[model samples]
Target: MWLYITIGLVALLIGIAIGFFIARKYMENYLKNNPPINEQMLKVMMTQMGQKPSQKKINQMMQQINKLQKK
Candidate 1:
């Protein structure tokens, strides 16, 4: 009885670990393909804040965002 209980607990723990990794990988891929924010969204946000967003400015902001995400 004790052996079966120990085996069941071990299997449960292993399953949990594998599921966490799989979910994490899926989300990373999803986010990479579809970033949370894009240039258009950024431009709209800047416009709403009363700033005229230039292409160069948008590019710079995107670089900064990518840098932060990498960290």
Candidate 2:
């Protein structure tokens, strides 16, 4: 009974480690190809809060904001 319990614990730990490894790799690749949504959201919130941004940054920010708002 004790041996069975030890084997079960080891298997559980190995499974958890494998799951975390796969998830981390997937997320790393996913983020590399994807634009960060939070940054765009923050820019939109800042604009809504009425901050005076420069012309170029404002245009870029507005574009992202519009794109997100459309979705």
Which is the leading candidate under lDDT?
1
lDDT of candidate 1 over 1-71, digit per residue (tens): 99999999999999999999999999988988888999999999999999999999999999999998777
User: Which pairs, if any, clash in model 1?
Assistant: none
Q: What is the lDDT of residue 54 in candidate 1?
A: 99
Model 2, residue 17: C-alpha shift (Å): 0.8
Off by over 4 Å in 1: none
Please write out the lDDT profile of model 2 over residues 1-71, one tens digit for every residue: 99999999999999999999999999877865765655556667678889854567767875775577557
Model 1 accuracy (lDDT, Cα): 0.96
Q: How accurate is candidate 2 locally (lDDT)?
A: 0.76
For every model shown, the clashing-pair count is: 0, 0
